[model samples]
Target: MRLYSEQRFGLVRACVARDGQPLLYAEGYALDPSLTLWGTRSVARLSAKSGRIGFLKLADGQEAMTDLSDPDAINEGAALEIEIAAEARADKLPRARLIGMADGPLRRLSGPLPLIERLKSQARRLIDPQAVFEAAEDPDALDIAEAQAIHPSFDLPGGGYLSIEPTRALIACDIDMGGAGEGMIHTPRQAAKRLNEVAVAEVARRVRLSNLAGLVVVDLIGNKHNGEKLTGLVRDAFLAESPAIACGPITRFGILEFSRPWGARPHGEDTPLKAARRLLWRAVAEARSDAGGRLKLRAPGPVADLVRQCLKDSLDPLTPRLSVETASVTEVVPVR
Candidate 1:
């Protein structure tokens, strides 16, 4: 496996590619990575309690939710060091597990480890993603991989396409033949089987790529009466990666269901602040590469304000050479 790091503009973006396929992508501030918060132990106060569900406030003022192993053992306002299991979502708090009570002051004891240390186990070769981005042609390899994680539709190997939509409840995958069998009306079953084969393989790769967890339902292209064959194909595809925690047979509606253990937050689920930071980084790169003495970056009003407010320090070095303005769309261009 190869890990690519693009360290620029006070941000570090990394992608892990195995066997020519990009599986995971993560980014964070230069010093502290948001990914490190998961799986790290920290001190937090039990702000509020409701039975086994407890609300925890970290020293940094962040809140998380975790089940109290012994609800009776701890009371509200007490301190406990908890291990974060997963990062937070837009509507949900981070998931944590109690690691026992703490005696010291409420603060981060250790954590936010170096990005390389956290991800080095999965990769052997360290690469530079920016090199790939600069050398690649239109639809760069890294860009295509990143787009697949965010975009809902991706084409199959030979033909057809699959739409993978992840909702709060489960991930739903829909497959379409889409002219894969245009002139083969005589062999509909044979054509459908081939399409389904391609769809299942792509579906499995996407599940790993997007870090999708929980229940996943796939609606295959053709409706045949072979449940075992469909599930077996999925199982074989996921055998290399972590096999599903549980795999269910295909349903009558041509749907297959399976569940995988939660790993990290799904890609493209960034908060507004994180998105703004990324945009600012892109703008900075544009300015650095331009030959003009001055450059103007037009971005959404809120995004412009974010950089001007919270990220002013990041731009101080390039002031006079770069300026930001509010526009409906975000882009950077050299000043005349």
Candidate 2:
């Protein structure tokens, strides 16, 4: 989340250690006026080889390299340490004094130390609020355009519309026993148990697909039955979805809160199927309007090819004025 400068571009860098070694580094860039920032586009460029130091070009074309070979060159190697003389002036660039040598090979020349210092000095000013806002808003248009294609007027069970919000905390689901029946033979307790079981399964699936994490609250249908039965059902459901997720005991109000560890946060809200359909439709429309009026799409490989074949088989019979094309976006992976 911190921002720094790198050359003329703004750089956001974070220090990370791997295998007890302070080697991993995260670097991001602020978008220039012409470019739009959308979602978490920050790429974590890690060193592929051990003891190897190199620079990576961020999205904004800002360069960052580690000086692992020499400690003296602050801007030349992966190491950031440097020495200064007592008489050194504040305005002038300090002379590079060799403090120590690193135990690795030097890959490339780091940027100038004065420029690096200036970037570090103006780090606060570079962290622009406007830039974050611009980036966050860029993805909405695409999501909306995609959603419209999938469901022109899709409606949720409740009156709420589909929305994407940015938050550090994970999303939780609560199911209340609405105006359902409470019978003497079946008992309200039995109904509550069934509803709780269904809610647990559905919530788990949503968490996985949405990449939700942290605390999750699930308010089940309140019943006069034993709380132990409800707690056991929730526990079993959690285990079935993911054993790693830890859950607290059911609360007196019949609320179950749990946590799911997510490797990375989601950038957008469209499901895989919905995203693919939107992209495909947009490309078709574009291709139709082009000079040649022919459409060609780059898909992920076999899947793309299959989609293209399906499109051809379905649309070829129409014999329309424009030609539609299809291809694979990527290679197929074994279904989990």
Candidate 3:
């Protein structure tokens, strides 16, 4: 058995080398004056086999052992050199500067086990040491399912609908109070307040869920004199819910402007507009091929008129099988 003990007197920088080649170096810091690694500490781990670098949390007194001989492929002969440096701290923990080296001939102690079992065993020991030993002798009494469902969703009262319309450049939500407001206090102001509160919460959630980026405008029901109050409420609600999100100030026009990080919109499974455009193009192509002539499409309504005007201005008439579609209130599935 090889015993490996490492204690930091002050700030320590540890370098890990494999096969006489420098693999990685890590620096540990004491955030508090007491020299305790309670808060976040920087840790860097680099791959010897691959040149990839990884950063992680370095908690004090955390030890891990692995065998190099097994299929796990841990190279135990890998040398580790630790360099200690002294720092002035008000707490006066200790001051020592020394270099340390360690080597181990790793050996496997047990076969591979399921992650759940390993975690359960580790947690049991940490939480209740006496119970862990007793429970080890009698394993049949433990209810695994109780531990599995640790965090479950609490059901919401309202059946809310969230509509993300990119064309409109706005997210409109229609929420039905849904039986929860049956016997409670009911007034336009009160109702608006409650709905606004719920909507604000939902907005933050949807922003995260949808990962929507760019200028977002929310068209919420206007509250009379409480407009400014409502805006403040929504702004405060979002700030509390998601501190990381950079939301801008709400304008007097009830437009809330903010930007999410750039990427593909989440849950962006084929929109109806895209589907309609695809179908329209396919149909126009088929029509042109059948007639062996150029196809002309007329503007149908206000939305279609806008699309036609746009097409005429933006596209060339000589372009083959040109297709166009417009936005509408009705939901239609385009057929090929």
Candidate 4:
């Protein structure tokens, strides 16, 4: 797999690709050596306990949870060492595992590892993003624009499309044959089976790409029998992408159910911090190109405050020209 990292919108964006196709994308503040949940060792105080689960609060006030072997072994407010296993995704809290009791001072052993280092561990070849962008017919614009897409659809290789609906409870996937079966000279049943197979493979890729977890229901374009026969294919397809998946048999209603583990943050979650970063990134780019006196970032109150708080960390030689102003909408423009 090839990996590329570039600074955009005040954050380091990384993309993992295989055979010239993007597999995964991630973004973060690379220079900040402060507290972060992903890939860090820190000390936390046990805030609460319930059976085998122990809730903890780090020195930076980030909440995490770990499995305790014995409920009564450690009391609340006790200090413990932890290694963060995964980041906070969707509504789920960050996950960590106990590394034994902490020593004298309750402190963080290390901050979050750099995002580029993390990507390098998994990638086979590291190439400059500009090279990839220049060579591709349509360079991948990895940005927050995806968060604006609520109900996204992807066209399948054949004549069909897959519509994905992500709700608070679960994700719903619908397979529309469209014109995929038009030229097929097989029986209706056979044609549906063929389309289902291709659709399931694509579903597996999308699930991983979006970091979709919890319960997922896929509505295949086939009958109950066709759904049942395609169960193994579904299982294998998901297994190739995510190994720890629990797949249920095809239901009588022609639906395939399965669950995958949550890892990274959901691909398209729009938040104030992301908006703030985007505005700053644009402001910085504008300051670099245009001979402007003041680059004012106008955003919503919350986003503007976020930009002000992070202004120091993101500023480079353009520090003197940077400013933040509250506005109903978010934008970065020059001010005389």
Tell me the whole-model lDDT of each prediction, alpha carbons only. Answer: 0.70, 0.37, 0.33, 0.69
Number of the top lDDT candidate: 1
Question: Model 1, 311: alpha-carbon shift in Å?
Answer: 6.4
Question: Which segments of candidate 1 are over 4 A away from where they belong?
Answer: 33-36, 121-139, 236-244, 281-289, 300-302, 305-320, 326-329
For residue 116, give model 2's deviation from the true position in Å: 42
- The residue pairs found clashing in candidate 4 are none
The C-alpha TM-scores of every prediction are: 0.82, 0.36, 0.28, 0.79
TM match of model 4 to true structure = 0.79
By TM-score, the better pick of 1 and 4 is 1
Candidate 3 — what's its lDDT?
Answer: 0.33
Off by over 4 Å in 2: 1-168, 182-186, 223-243, 267-279, 282-336
Ranking according to lDDT, highest score first: 1, 4, 2, 3
What is the full ranking by TM-score, best candidate first? 1, 4, 2, 3
* Residue 153 displacement in candidate 1 (angstroms): 1.9
What is the lDDT, from 0 to 100, of the residue 256 in candidate 2?
72
Model number with the top TM-score: 1
Error of 2 at 336 (Å): 45
**1 versus 3: better TM-score goes to:** 1
Cα lDDT of model 3 by residue, 1-336, tens digit: 011111122222222222222112222221122212111112211123222211111123322221122323333234322211222222222121112223442221133333223333322322222222111211111112111111111223353333444433544443444443555555655654565566655554444333334455565544343555545655553443244345665556655555433222222333332233333344444554555444444333553453343345444332344444454442222223
- TM-score, model 3 to reference: 0.28
- What overall lDDT, based on C-alpha atoms, would model 4 receive against the true structure? 0.69
